[model samples]
Target: MLLPRSYINISFFQPPAFLLIGIPGLEAAHGWISIPFSSMYAVALTGNCLILLAITRTPSLHQPMYYFLSMLALTDVSLTLSTLPTTLAVLWFDHQSIGFNTCLVQMFFLHTFSVVESSVLLAMSFDRFLAISNPLRYAAILTNNVIIRIGIVIVTRATVSIFPVPFLLKRLNFCPNKTLLSHSFCFHPDVMRRACDDITINILYGLYVVASTASIDSLLIALSYALILRTVLGLASPRERVRALNTCVSHILAVLVFYIPAIGMSIIHRFGKHLSPIVHVLVAYVYLLVPPVLNPIIYSVKSKPIREAMLKVLRKKGQGS
Candidate 1:
């Protein structure tokens, strides 16, 4: 008995789903691998939630810097949650099938939060520069109204920029039986590569989004820091200079944690074709997982105000319990 022609055509053009590979060569070690990943996800969730709670609860933490930090924490929580379901499912249950539309939804949120995180980091750098460069007007410059507007713009820009991606992807016809995604999550590049149709438009649009968003944000962030250093150098008191730079160390760490792995993963995907599949998958995990897991810890350890607020929050919780 042969299958119907229309059914065959439909299956060819519209694949039922895509297969996600947890870790290509380490299938046997998946159980062991899930331990660390699950732990990191838990940390990312708890830490970011605590940071948000601390910021929202403490009246003293209502400054522009803390506002931006709260935004960052929120973005981290979103980024972590976006990948957690699919990643854990693959690792814990070996459930690899993801519907085509579902894959697109996952890809949208993952990349959207990533871009929002990048933008928030840039905004935080600007906050630092203003605080160090012009302390007198810092509050005036980044008033609550201004911060709110910036937050809106950050989210709107990310959503609008990434909105076209799914539509573009929908137009392409994926290769038959070639729907194996590289990572446990759906990535734009990985999904695009599966298309049997011409993906020139998709590639160009993807590059455009990256260059306009993350690349520009990175350059501006570096410039902001450079000006901050110059301003710090001009101060007569060595102690003042030390204090100023100390304020930036945490933000610098946060930026590095977010960007280094992210850029490394992009480079690996584009240029490290000769490298093993495990290398690509591992780097991808680092890019998605490390920043969210570490950002809260970095801030809590380095920022006294946040640490105190978090402590207060914990104490309150303990008493309530």
Candidate 2:
């Protein structure tokens, strides 16, 4: 397909289609690498689906904490879907060319859901804090109606915040040879770097969104945990304290599973220029793929209710079969 052309620097450039790169220095092993990537994606898809199924089918999980968890599961599934096609196309078929508008669409959803995930985690931390600090008023504070409003705000904030990114990139002129991206997906930084025009606005706007969402969310999550700790410590019963602390274990694991690789990827991009290209690519893959694959497992092993619900779902299917 002939992509839209941009006349820049007295040269005809197909600025609409950008080529995506598989793992650098490991192109020869992309086929071999895809085995694990496909497996991880499969696990992520199945695990998250089960979480959603369990939440929806089980009546007891219709509380605020589980509501936020269901939101997280949906975001994870959306993130996986957004990146899976291009990633597999690059890895399995060695197909890397992506059209401009399609790339923009992918970038929008990719970033929007990522920010949504961060926001959801922050909300979950708040839910934990409320449950621990004010057990009596937890339901009153985060009622079903309140949770629905929060969900709306999460989606709206992410969409509004990230909506300008593609338009900003659209205004820039991309040079033909510079259209090769570092990863199998179209990332903002990767795509922005290809532009021959000024991108100070794009860079600044990207930073603004990051600061507003992930950075701020991280601080708030920490604050919530600190309060939860204080509240738990004040409890007279040692067993009660342990149980309260234990409730947060799954969330802590989820946060670590998410932010560590995300921060690692950011560090690699900004400071790890001296590192191998493979390192950057590998970290990017982990950042995008790991959390979804592990979150369901974390909750299943930690939260007895969710595990029981999931098992009940499986048994029903088994009996039906």
Candidate 3:
């Protein structure tokens, strides 16, 4: 509850707790800032949950696209939930102190969900690729059983990949009495750097995981779109081209919304020496926050079935009122 206090290892102590400052440089404004952040989170929760509900209730949305959209909705909720409580607690309630185990748990969930979301996006891209490039075989390729299997593979990939990180971190000793997190959360890099031991393995392992998962996924998604574009361009009718590209609009925006901030944050972390801590924190937060806040809105606007289902629900409620 209190800010994490500095401790000495003179006596036998349990795992050390770390402080979670909401916005490091703007401590005085954390209260005011939480208002907008909380509003975004509220919208994100409402939108994503409604998407899941609409997809479930609407039999027409039983197709692959809507199924993937539902998975994205679920992952968005998971992503929002992974860090929202602790982040808000730090900002609103000044509950900045968190134990080692708690921090590890939070970090694992945050990173795992992120990995899962990336995997889901990759899977969705593959779905689009199949639908566009091989229309005749689309249904055969992306049947319910296949989608279910993809979902299982996604969860398994993320869970297995992230399972070792916290344990890897736990093996290291934080010789320093107190270590501060950059954002209002425990980041893997920040946690790894806190240790006095040789962290080459930590850094290397983290890079390997990112390279194998997120980087590879992004590259493959790009290839998928490139192929999709080639296919779309070959179509004779302008309307067909427009319609095909229109279907990809939401996905492209989703990918850009996710990757741009993510890439920016990474760039800033690596090279933006002039940038302040506030920039890093905000960028990092936005990388996670913006996707959830935008995904449902994008889907509802771009996908006709979802839009109609949403309007239908609204009309039913209006008539009831």
Which pairs of residues collide in candidate 3?
A: none
Q: How much is 135 displaced in model 1, in angstroms?
A: 0.8
List runs of model 1 lying over 4 Å from the truth.
1-12
What does candidate 3's lDDT look like per residue over 94-164, in tens digits?
88888889999999999998898898889889888888888899998899999999999999999999999
Q: Which ten residues in a row have the lowest lDDT in candidate 1?
A: 1-10
> 1-321 in candidate 2: lDDT tens per residue?
433343444543437588999988889999999999999999999999999999999999988999999999999999999999999999999998999999999999999999999999999999999999999999999998899999999999999999999999888877766878888998998889888788899989988998999999999999999999999989999999999999999999999999999888888887898998889788988989999999999999999999999999999989999
Candidate ordering by lDDT (highest first):
1, 2, 3
Task: Give per-model TM-scores.
Answer: 0.96, 0.96, 0.93
Question: Which window of 10 residues has the lowest lDDT sum in candidate 2?
Answer: 3-12
Candidate 2 lDDT for residue 178: 83
Model 3 bad stretches (over 4 Å)? 1-15, 315-321
- Pick the winner on lDDT between candidates 2 and 3: 2
**Quick one: how many clashes does candidate 1 have?**
0
The candidate with the higher TM-score, 2 or 3, is 2
Best-to-worst TM-score order: 1, 2, 3
